[model samples]
Target: MKKTGLTIAAALAGALLGSPALAQKTVLTVGMQSTDAGVLDPHLNSGTPGKAMLQWMFNGLVRIKPGELSPEFMEPDLAESWTSSTDSKEWTFKLRQGVQCHHGYGEFTSEDAVYSLARAASKETSAFSSDYAAFDKVEAPDKYTVKITLKQAIPSLLGIVMNYHGGNMVCKKAAEELGKEGFAKKPVGTGPFMFQEYVPQQYAKLVANPNYFRGKPKLTEILYRFIPSDSSRDLAFQSGEIDMMLGRQEQAWVDRMNALPGVKVVAMGPAEMSMLHLNMSQPPLDNLKVRQAIAYAVDRNAIWQFRGKNISRPAVSVVPSGYLGTDEKAPLYPFDLAKSKALLAEAGFPNGVTIKAINTTLPSMLSFTEATQALLKRAGITLEIQPVEHATFHQQIRQDLSQVVHFQAARFPIADVYLSQFFHSRAIVKTPTAVTNFSHCKVADAEIDAARSETDKAKQLALWKTAQEKIIKEVCAIPVNEMMQLWAYKDSLDLGYDLKASLNLGPPVLETTRFTK
Candidate 1:
């Protein structure tokens, strides 16, 4: 009797362990390269890591189709349907009824949409206010309808309104009640995840939203860990402490991670174009010959090789290659050390030129800047790099503290957006309407303005090409290589969709994501 009872007990224990409920994974931990988020408010935060966290906690009226990067694949999210005027100056969006906000924040309505749009367009609130400069007004006609009037028709109204940058919506009532500071710390939105807690320089904890519009998420919770160090983050992922991590943008790192058992490395687009913007307002760079010399010193092919062919490609124009209206034939300065030296001599710098820059300490950015430094040294140009924390680097550079600014960014995949932000006079840094014109480049302003309202597709493309030609001729900025997004995850984790590209610049963890084991 004792032997039989023991045998039954052992069998029961094994059965309990093998049950479906006990075998499923309930939590997922993601490691990102950031010390901590400056804020959680969708309209205010601009850091890549902050954007990744916001993706889980918020939803825009329209969103890029999951696992896709282009605006052409955008589909309705909070808004059920939308219509625009023939001129494309006016747009009306119909909000989905019965969509509930996280944490009992009440249902989403047109009021929230209007409030969020106005907030994002305000320079006092959003970092991307320039993107909405064409907006005349945003109003709610009814409880479920939102109307927007633009001063001028853009290439795609949906590009600015989709779930990216300033487009992510927030709970109107929650924002009003919590105020700016409180709401940033504890945001309320309508998505699969809800903010639970945030520890500075540590981690952010989010819980599954049971009242999610689509459905309850399979995972019980998500812990977004802040592991800035590459080696530490990689070790955590290898030790099974983190389910996913942002991988280094190097071929060696990708090869090493891919070889690991049960580890999957993802390299996808659309890539960020890394460009070196010489501040023309600054003394040394103000000289045209000096600017041209710096351009001749950079080797685009060398940079692309350093980051591997799978993850990077040489940039062909001022605007990223693959963007709409980009002219592949746009003139580029070839890498000629002798030409660089001659130009420096003609500029009255017979010995060498020393250019100062405030650069980011982030491994990915620092590595690129250091490589440029080595290349410039060979051409008798000294690149003085002062490395600071990532956040500080962005702050100081925008304040016009850097003589040379190496900015890497992926915009709305449109020539107008890139040209206007980087070369138009209105966006010159330190000015009231400044966006990111670090070079203080105004040569392409005419072509950029013409292209914005051009109704004809061919005419618009021609205008954009002219703008690129002007920017390149003046040597306003040297186009470097484009670096694709890279990340690694465990093979057992099912992301529920093909991992192609994400505008959020990180892996998308949806409600359907789960562990197969």
Candidate 2:
């Protein structure tokens, strides 16, 4: 027998209009490891909860297809259509009609779009300020059209920039009325869900928007719970305390969950890169030879096996695989101890070297830190790993506190976004304009700039590859592995999409997500 694509609405119709199998779903509670939502201001909320919340609470001018990570899958979102000038410096977007702002903020228009971009480009508020350094100005033509003029052309604007959180629309009147503190506590946007309550380090609750333009959300309510401990979260999932649990990076954990009755675990692909971040401004690590030694010391393959061969693959480039221009054959450290020790000796550390770095509670970071610590020890390098609270760890890392940083993140679904945010000199940490440049190692800045400016896709990709090759060649930091994201949920749950891969690891429980009959 063939199984039909059973939509929630169809299932409900069959129940009342035909026959009943199980009750319809209206709410779902998901357990995650993030401690808090941080700042819920769309520009500042770079954390997992904040990112997921932003998607639910706001709509971008342009958006990637739901549950799709590829750049080719982008579609019209807030802006129904848009056009660019010949030079690609100026872009005009025609705003969609009747898109009301969440909670009577007034109908969304070009004004909100301009305001949000202006705010995002503000140094005081936005982490993405550096990414938009090329912006000249934004204008609202009449009330339904927005014109963004960039000082320099950015080739990746359409595929990435417009769809990101920084570009997501926010009602000008509502945001200004609430102010920074008020806005963080309660945000208003034009999405299917509306903010209900935020409990800080515990849970953030959101209710379905009745007046949503795309029709009301299927789930009446969605609650996000913060559970930092891996074991505790797994236990909660087993006990059915949480409807969904974020899976650990380890294979054994996922296998155990899969073995459980009435439980299903999904390993989502092209997750993100887990990199061995080296602070170029810091001591022995400041030496390129030392950085190369560190890279050659660790075994990316073995470390990946610790998680599972099926769930992860060795990172070949800083941008990682799956994104366009990410070469599968990109160069990497071959895990040679003798060569690493030789490089260390050449870098003025003959016998051994000790490096201090902090680790987060997140399984990805902790696992990388611990696994690499042993490998480095074997190569006569001692790595002191200090575990820090996730929030504190983020603050300290940006302040240039650690010599090495083992971080995992899916920055964006494009090559430019990842390269610019992580490698660009303007994005250096602790400076007035700071983003996520953990290593503070400048590699091919001019090349990256040229790539962004290049209108031709082939040339842009070539320049991006050139920049990444320079990074790998300079041994700025070690590219460890790109891990898989696993989510454990009840068997009855039926997410509308095929769950192939997600741009972000969050389960796509949109208006279509429900339970099967």
By lDDT, who's the top model here? 1
Clash count per candidate:
0, 0
Per-residue lDDT of 97 in model 1: 92
Query: Over 4 Å off in model 2, which ranges?
Result: 1-23, 159-163
Tell me the deviation in Å of residue 238 in model 2: 2.6
Q: List the residue pairs that clash in candidate 2.
A: none
In candidate 2, how many Å is residue 38 off?
1.7
Q: lDDT of model 1 at residue 459?
A: 95
- Provide the TM-score for each candidate, comma-separated: 0.96, 0.92
Error of 1 at 55 (Å): 1.0
Which lDDT tens digits does candidate 1 get at residues 8-95? 9998898889876677887999999878776888887777788878899889889988888877888999998999999989999999
TM-score (C-alpha) between model 1 and the true structure: 0.96
In order, the Cα lDDT scores of the candidates are: 0.89, 0.80
